[model samples]
Target: MSEPSLQHPLTGKRILVTQADAFMGPVLCEVLEEQGATVIASREDIADPDAPRRIVDQAGSVDILVANLAVPAPSSRVGDVSAGEWRDTFATMVDPLPRLMQAVLPGMREQGHGRVLVMGSASALRGMKRASTYSAARGAQMAWTQSVGVELAPENIQVNLIAQNFVDNPTYFPPEIQENPRFQERLKREVPLGRLVSAREDAQFAAYLCSDAASCFVGQVFPVCGGWVNR
Candidate 1:
């Protein structure tokens, strides 16, 4: 492993963070930059089949790829889940992933070292009401990560994901939800941690995963759900 600066775990690393303005993108980019990495932030929606390849081409060679893909969770009941809705969910969250991986691998393979971290959800790690579509999509993300992470392991490309929920983010748990009494009670009762994990806390963990120190953790799904999924 290379000697990294204690104050800058990612110093000299070039990282590409997709969906730069959403999910954990902003905070993730901030943390990576603070750790001295060159962050190419992309705010484009990758639902288009061609977008992933185009985005990866635009970013060129990066030491790390932060696939911060996300979309609003569908609240449609299982019985009423439309074909359009289900296809759209996978199109938005699952389809473009392989393109991005395929596009980035050639460069990573040449360099002999790279990292890919998916800022995914824990909804798939556990069950939830009215979240069948969301959970399935997230499950596909983790499953793909496992397969690709292993396939690319010998090439020195580490792939892993953070299966997270109950984290303080505008997307999943907004301020309004946090302020609601019922939601607060639910948080207290459901999450063993009894609170939402801060966005910074999650991003900090992501930074470590992108660093040289975390090279040994290939294809693993690290849960960061404050124990909500355990229940």
Candidate 2:
């Protein structure tokens, strides 16, 4: 670990990162902690309606909530999308969102300040073949962030989403797939960055957002996809 900065942006802040073992959760937790946050890393299943509140309650007072949720993206075409896939995707990614808000908002309100950052996907930003179900769920997450971000801004609570794609992580881009020649060609043809965004780069930005410096942003969907959204 690098030496701690003289001024820790997240010093004394209590951050709760959900689904700590998945998607961007591990990196987010690692970066936030390095920045001096007391992190509550939970790897619980939040699909149950009560799980969100339970997790929040167990963590007690939270200064920031990182809604880092994910599941294996399904590539079923629109015509082949199963009802089960749709329900499960939303259940895992979308459903827990509002429940988490409800659980944490009251505590934040009492404190007069809070931050909620959703780790979402850019699949919802652009069209992709055979991603109907996964995209819709991610799209719902983006929409929810926009709506709730505005609603909570007046209360000094900031809600935002990071719509990311083509980032280097084991979940979406494992080593074997990244080493493939065809995948390299795709990177050249697609991502403007011509490479996967480093996981630390992404996590560092997330840490900044969770810090006090990001108070001006509200309900914004920042794309961190190596310019993939534009392509």
Best by lDDT: 2
Model 1's number of clashes is 0
- Cα-based TM-score, every candidate: 0.96, 0.95
Taking all chains together, the TM-score of candidate 1 against the true structure is 0.96
Give per-residue lDDT, candidate 1, residue 158: 97
| lDDT for model 1 | 0.90
List, residue by residue over 4-54, the lDDT tens digit for candidate 1.
698998988999999899888899999999998999999887998888888
Steric overlap count per candidate:
0, 0
Task: Quote the positional error of residue 208 for candidate 1 in Å.
Answer: 0.2
* Residue 183 accuracy (lDDT) in model 2: 99
RMSD (Cα, Å) for all candidates, in order, is: 1.7, 2.6
Clash list (residue pairs), candidate 2? none
